[model samples]
Target: MSIKKLLFMVVAFTLASAAAQAAPLRVGVEGAYPPFSWKEPDGTLKGFDIDVAYEVCKRLQRECVLVEQEWDGMIPALLSRKFDTIIASMSITEERKKKIDFTEKYYDTPPGIVAKKNAGFSQSNMAGKRLGVQRATTHQCTAEKMFPGAELVLYASQEEVFQDLASGRLDAQISDSLQASEGFLKQDMGKGFAFLGDMISDPGCQGVGAGFAVRKKDTLLRDAMSAIIKGMRDDGTYKILNDKYFEIDVYGK
Candidate 1:
């Protein structure tokens, strides 16, 4: 072989070896969004997002590690390279797309309002209520726009909002329908709370649905994840996870 070609081959081999030794894909999740990703009492993390991410990594032939992060800082952490990807039930919105890339949507649920059963409020009655939502979430933005007169209380997490709602600090709370249905409705703490019909609109906030997030420059990783997510949807693993958490199919045909 020519000397130039031999040198090229040696450099290529070294690069390939370095790539092979790259660390496992580290996925960041809030680890507090029940039915999506959350920590168990035993310290292990599990849920829909956890299951879906595991499937995606398996399809990509890559090991997966889950990193617990607060909801407010999840995106910034992703940009700072604290994790390789985010699977924290993040929605694909134009606002977010400007900062980071997203895989195709894997699950979806409309935004809904949860209020005390005796509150006697509907979508139209939201004018004076104190609505609680997680800070830096689409729900918070939607509540602000949809109910201009309502007091929007931004909490750090869904758990915090729910806690305040149960303790009578909040008149109502807005969140994804599936999350309200599973995490709140099914729990004892949500005994007297009810969804005031579906307040679906604003595809950017309540309609489009959820997907994983990655840095815009990680095109290879994003493409691989998108393909894996598509396969999971087609092969029914996605449905199984949905069924485990929700009574109805949130990801429709």
Candidate 2:
């Protein structure tokens, strides 16, 4: 081969290698939140949040590297630089904003109560019943305030909350309304379960809505992601994923 040709090939290969070296966007996710994020029996993650993350990465022209983190440790991991961002359906509460920044809300939904159809718990009163909720979630905060009299049964994961509820160990549970409906109520184990009363909306604990969370210093990345999220909503990409997981529009008014 000619020396000139060899030099040209070397430069092309170097450029290609550099392009390949572009860092992938490391996204934190919780594999236990169903309909939004969950692990299948085969250990593959698939859910609305998962889809949205992949879509956002595609628009950003970067490869996506999903890092599974427990729900309770999500924000701490992000702060510790374990991941660049969290796309795990985390709510954008003022309390959290004190610790990190959030992109514009991607979706909004209210929490709901789930109980056996025969259970007679009032919306305004549940003096001594056991109420299950995942630890460190808006649902926990909301339940504590809304049903101050009820005993809060804290669990590590929403799946565990559902399990206890299904076994009659819990009188009720408070969780994302859509998640309860799709993840538990619609399933076989939840055959006799139904949502009680109206959906609960507490701006204080539940926040305005769910959004992508990033380090406070990553304003540029947050803004870029916010724009991409807006684009997805305007271009119907958000609706496509929303419809895939929920029967109704979860992006609240």
Candidate 3:
């Protein structure tokens, strides 16, 4: 047999072997956040972030497995290898970068406050009114640092923060503006509450925006997802997703 033909066969075999060995990536998402990710009543996970994850895996020629993780536990789970990456709407903050690596901002949105229409809450004169935010989140950190005088309450989930806001246990709730808008203010339970104050931006706390979180050593997967995100944004898939889940560009200007 010719040496050229033998070399061709060897190359094809090696390529096939590598393809066969590549494992599906297990992606973690906080299932409680809507528009980004959530479990359907039927228990299947679906949302903008999930869609993005599946497409990214498709582009990389790998299967994507979705794992539901509590918002606060996502980083720990990733470090423990509970999942390969976190595609939840986790913002890319400086503080988080110390522990895990992140893809470029997949999406960015401002933070805001919510309160009963008649309730008076502001950065100024917030001494007596209480505020609530989801624990272990940028919102919690921002509220703590920004509202030094207000009594800040932290909840395990954004839903709980909204619950307390509705029940009057909290005079106000702080969260991602999009979540406060579409997730609560537009819903039945948000009947009397309205968005308060301007959209908040503090790079120290909020950073640029949300990104796919990966273990620090997993540069290959991180780079692949980042390329896919840039491709989607250039193409129109990202905008299509933004339109589907939200009325505004969550990716920010």
Per-candidate clashes come to 0, 0, 0
* Global fold similarity of model 3 (TM-score): 0.90
- Highest TM-score: give the candidate number: 2
53-80 in candidate 1: lDDT tens per residue?
A: 7887777777888888898898999999
Per-model C-alpha RMSD: 4.6, 5.7, 6.1
Instruction: State each model's CA lDDT, in order.
Output: 0.84, 0.92, 0.86
Best by lDDT: 2
Q: Model 1: residues >4 Å from true position, as ranges?
A: 1-18
Query: Which candidate, 1 or 3, has the higher lDDT?
Result: 3
How displaced is residue 208 in candidate 2, in Å?
A: 0.6
Supply the TM-score for candidate 2.
0.91
Off by over 4 Å in 2: 1-21
Off by over 4 Å in 3: 1-21
By summed lDDT, the worst window of 10 consecutive residues in model 1 runs over 198-207
